[model samples]
Target chain A: MKHSLSSLLLAAVLPVALVACAPSEAGTTTDGGLSGKLTLTGSSTIAPLALEIAKRFEERHPDVRIDVQTGGSSRGISDARSGLADIGMASRRLKDGEIELTAHAIAQDGVCMILHASNVVASLTDDQVRAIYLGEIENWSEVGGEDAPITVVNKAAGRATLEVFTKHFGLDEKEIQADVIVGDNEQGIKTVAGNPDSIGYVSIGTAEYSAGSDVAIKLLPANGITASTASVGSGSFPIGRPLNLVTFGEVSKLQRAYIDFCRSAEVHDLVTGLYFVPVRTAQ
Target chain B: MKVKSTDRILVWSLRAASATAGSLVLLILCFLVLESVEGITRVGAGRFLNDPGWHPSQGAESEFSLVPMIAATIASTIGAILLAGPVGVLAAVFCRFYAPPKLARAFRSIVELLAGIPSVVYGFWGLVTLVPLVRELAPPGASLLAGILVLAMMIVPTVALLAFAALKNVPPGHLEGATALGLSRWTTIVKVVFPSAASGLGVAIVLGTMRAIGETMAVLMVCGNITKVPSSLFDPVRTLTANIALELGYATQEHRAVLFVSGLALMIMIVLLVFVQERLQRRARLA
Candidate 1:
């Protein structure tokens, strides 16, 4: 009885081992056929935008497949420069010393402060915003709000949102005292909406969408510039950052085609649909 | 002869499977050590253990101290066990002793169902329910207490189930003998039943502690991921698991290596906890 059982198990395993060693067919892409598989990774912000564009690009070139992944902007930059990905999606401008790769601006977004709609304070000066985040300003009354203690919501470490916010505020990431540490824009908005005295900063696009849908969160002006698509497009917002696609040195014909597709005017609507300003509109 | 051959093959295959499991653990340890070598050399193992500062974002001068994270992990685990241990053991006692047979069966099923619920669901429930309640009493809701409460809730079912089984394993004759000695119900339970099942209860406690220490999402959701040693129960602190989960996605060479070191430390701590538990159980059995 056990002999048959062992034989049955062996028969099942041998075929699986053979199948696993077999070369995958979809990996072969002709040099000039525009049918190769492309993997785009990094920047959760850019992932959805890239996904939309990839979907349309796939519709156009039925033989090509583009895989879009999000692991934050640092992952995108590292993956692209290290040749782990065809194109890396980054939500912020590239810093110095990342010269091995070239950044192509595909869209524009801004980091802006968000408050509960019930907040009596509609706008705060840049100094007050900085102080509030740095733990110098502790209560809403200090910033023209009710007498409740302020709940400062900040992003977790290694997030692009935290990096941008810290740089803009002229404070180190470690200096900020956060009441609640949220990972993404939705959580930031949720934290702010749930607490009347809470203040947080997130992508202008995500905050605007949440505010429009009556989620009880509203965007505040930064340094006299409103956090909006127009302000980001017109170069009035200091907190605005480019959404870039980075590739190392010279890209392949297939890579160029995908980059061109992402920058094409057809994606303008999709970019706006995500509440992000188009690169063309900004320039 | 065919039967003998078949039996030998079956035994060999089973031995091979067990060897695979054992080798996999060794493989994991080897990888962890290899990856952590850089971090151990960069910061020196002494500083990594002694220093409380963890500032990996400061480019070259970044510190990779596991002191605060380690303290937080232990503090929260102890806090969780303290809150859950008594409640779980008591619940188990009630189910085994006082409750009717049908009711006990129903209660056991409810606890088993709780054990089946995903950790993320517990996290979400804690975030939505317990966090707000904590916020009302305290200024900032995401504190060590909130983490303890969430972790306690997550581990109670496991502890209760195990404790129930431990108490059930105690011989009926032991209980009957205690009752015949004219001891009251509560005293009989405490003196005779508990001593008889002490080692099993120790196992239950150790398993509960492991679950609490290893829990990531629920504690992360409730514990403010502040990388400081908590001065009070209301203060927010980050655990080793939470730190790795939050930053591993974007961590680079040195940062990644340091996280591996933290993982290694966590593994060592777990081994030490199990060793202590075994010693305690052995001592109790001798007594």
Candidate 2:
């Protein structure tokens, strides 16, 4: 028995013994924020966009590599406010009086209410949209669509898109029943497209980004007008909101360079192509 | 007729005790029933149990299956056990059989220190260290390897401490009997010491599994937060707790309900595991 126990001990220790010798990288890159390096996190909605801008800036100035991660807008703002991140990105404007980080409006984005392309819904009134999201309108036939229940697709808490959409549609303070909480834009769309009776809101940019993909979801025109930059800029789309790149009150030279590049025409062109309205230009 | 004084007091206390206990159980039951009503209604009993995909948004059919989440939870916890179980048991053995008095005391102190460290700090370390390591070693990097590795590190102290305490309780007389039988040191430990403590070790394993399954922060940091089943050692994976933490804040109605369903499943699994441990203990004693 003693020998057996000893053998068991050896069995457990062997694998762990092999793992204790984990290697560590020995070099440090000096960059813009702190003396050693800078890391940023928060907001998945803007993370991909931020990555593109960060890559462009890093190439021009190789001294700093700003690492970004996505949690959500609340996490982004909170992390930046707590000094954990050098920058925070938000698809919606920061809640009033955010003194911790100076706000920078990088671009404008709007929400498009989408359904499966097979669904016969033509458009949704602002009141009908509100009622549906508020848990008042549960069936599609009630809203002149079909005889099916409407499955709501909402963003998870802290996502900037949810915040913006809730406010734009006046669904705040009302009970909204979500069928599922999606972790990312891609997943949210996937959930909506797979269901004929589901309606979800996503950034116009995301819908644009998803263009040419075989997603069966169709964007329903809100207020009887198609959702687009032209519709939004021309006061035709009612659910338009801002896409912002926010950062601390003061930052290092490299961080500033990154910000400048975000406003450049090359990035703006990408934003326009992706269906998001670009508010900045090369000038 | 007037009750006897002792009978009156006993009856009153029983009434009070039962009311409190019964109410507590009822409240919990009510909460679970209300929380899960949508899924229970949508999928009915048989479909909810047998269906796959777990998509609450699948509409008409009412996708309430928990397959992906169950897969993730089991995968993460099992991964953690695989990572922490051996290391912890070995540490306990070293403390019990090999360490000198001062060294053992020091190890005890260190293990206690590790046990006291909060889940958030472990999560932070996982985010900083484990994620990068996983990204480097695995093809995709930020995958299950990182989550498993970090959870193992976080839970080892728990298993080690439990094993050490159990080993310490082994009767000195048993060791003496084995030694008197001319058994070697290894034989005495493996044969005599181990059998006597198997029940305690089982409890230790159960406790470690509890910590591993219920752990939120550390697992959240390294698991990569993807909802898909893991294909490789390094693919990003999401667990039940991570899903709750990530989705709870914004989830409403059915989304919130689904999160609660996952929570319910997790709680049930833990309860069943502990129950099995108790059964095993009973069997071991009976034998």
Candidate 3:
């Protein structure tokens, strides 16, 4: 009986041990000689681009594994400083206090106000947008639209879009009276598309794609500059931020290779495909 | 002697399995308390009570209040229960008493199947279908009412299945006695069977409430997730679980710890609710 019980326990534990040890042995050998793993963490805006770049990089090297994680730009800075990740992706330029890290611009993404296609209000001045977000202008008629209460959709804290939107509008994040708070660009677009009275700001790339498609949303021009990938590439868009690959200090040979590949023209199609303007053309 | 040894081994293994299950809850509680210490001490407990808003990313100006979120959670859960309880019970009663045998079985299976559906699917359905329908009636359809309705739908199966079981537990002898006394079918179900199954039905409602309160994905997707006390059913609100789900992905340092504090608050609320339900059940049993 004791023998049978001991064997039963061993049978249960053996498979789990084998599964845990399988990943280390799975690295393929190739002539490229890069066999180490890299972890890049940070801004959700840059994560998709990073994932694509990582995928291509892995195909070339075969032995290199890249893991990309998204937690917002602040997490990118902190994780880079703490050595938790080999590289970090931040959608904004490095702030003054974060000068210790070096940034490599991979792409540019613009933030644009989005409203349901049914909204008659075409464009909003900076002040009008600020006033609407601050709850001073409650009704759409107050902003040259219908006589319905405007629903202000704000991004949740820690999202790069929220930081960029707030900084550009000069509105304090806390002071904005938001009716709905969405997490991602897709969610924001969905919310605005679902409600005619709702207004939200999301990635220009995402909004343009959705608008071009059958989605019932339209991008509002920011500060008289047309909110489009063309304006962003021409550097005429005022509310644009660089999608950066950040490193804390001296990088490893493999990390440098991956970062350079991300900035290179090889991944330009991937960048444009996701609606983000490639840094080479933007510059 | 070999059979005796086998029985001993079987009993010991069962005891070990139960012990592991019991200790895991304690381990989680300890971990939550340990993690939330920094948030509670640095952010100060008073802020959770005094402030009405949540702004975790504002550096020194950050407020760590859980009031609005807790109120939202409680309000939504209660609202969902109020909507789901009677309808679920009645549906179960219909399946048991009124429906044809084949139809009753089919209906019961359908209700059970709803319990198997993932909450994310329900959230997606609510986001696409229900939100737009509500917007036709009230613009900005991602309001508290949408959350309540979605949650009520999600937990209806739980309440219905439990109520069905409770109803089934009513003895054959009681129905026989009611029939012998010339009581109508409705009267027998209302006056005799209902009172006997009242405690079990209460349990079902409490379980449904528990499911609604702990739900995060469905509510987060449907609810507007605004950090404010909803003034009306149409007003958007963010629940405690939704707050944690939305922000914990990027939360760090004191901010991350505060998210843990939110989690601890949820755990405490659920534990307290279960405790209250247990006490009520015991009191009812005693009476």
- Top-lDDT candidate index: 3
CAPRI grade of model 3: acceptable
DockQ-best of 1 and 2: 1
- Candidate 1 lDDT over B202-249, as tens digits, reads 888898999998999888777878888889998878999998887787
Over the true interface residues, superposed, what is the Cα RMSD of model 1? 2.9
lDDT of 3 by residue, B109-224 (tens): 89999999999999989998888787777767888999999999999999999999888878889889999999998999999889888877888898899999999999998999
Off by more than 4 A, model 3: A1-11, A14-33, A281-283, B1-16, B277-287
lDDT of each: 0.85, 0.70, 0.89
Candidate 1 wrong stretches, greater than 4 Å: A1-7, A10-30, A230-235, A281-283, B1-9, B50-52, B277-287
Give lDDT: candidate 2, residue A174.
22
- Note the chain A TM-score of all models in turn: 0.90, 0.80, 0.90
Please give the range of 10 consecutive residues that has the lowest summed lDDT in model 1 chain A: A23-32
Per-residue lDDT, model 3, residue A22, is 66
Ranking by TM-score: 3, 1, 2
Clashing pairs in 3: none
Model 1's DockQ?
A: 0.44
Candidate 3 lDDT, tens digit per residue, A50-90?
A: 99989999999887899888888989989888888888889
| All DockQ scores | 0.44, 0.05, 0.46
State interface RMSD in Å for all models: 2.9, 17.9, 3.3
What is the Å distance of residue B150 in model 1 from its true position?
0.3
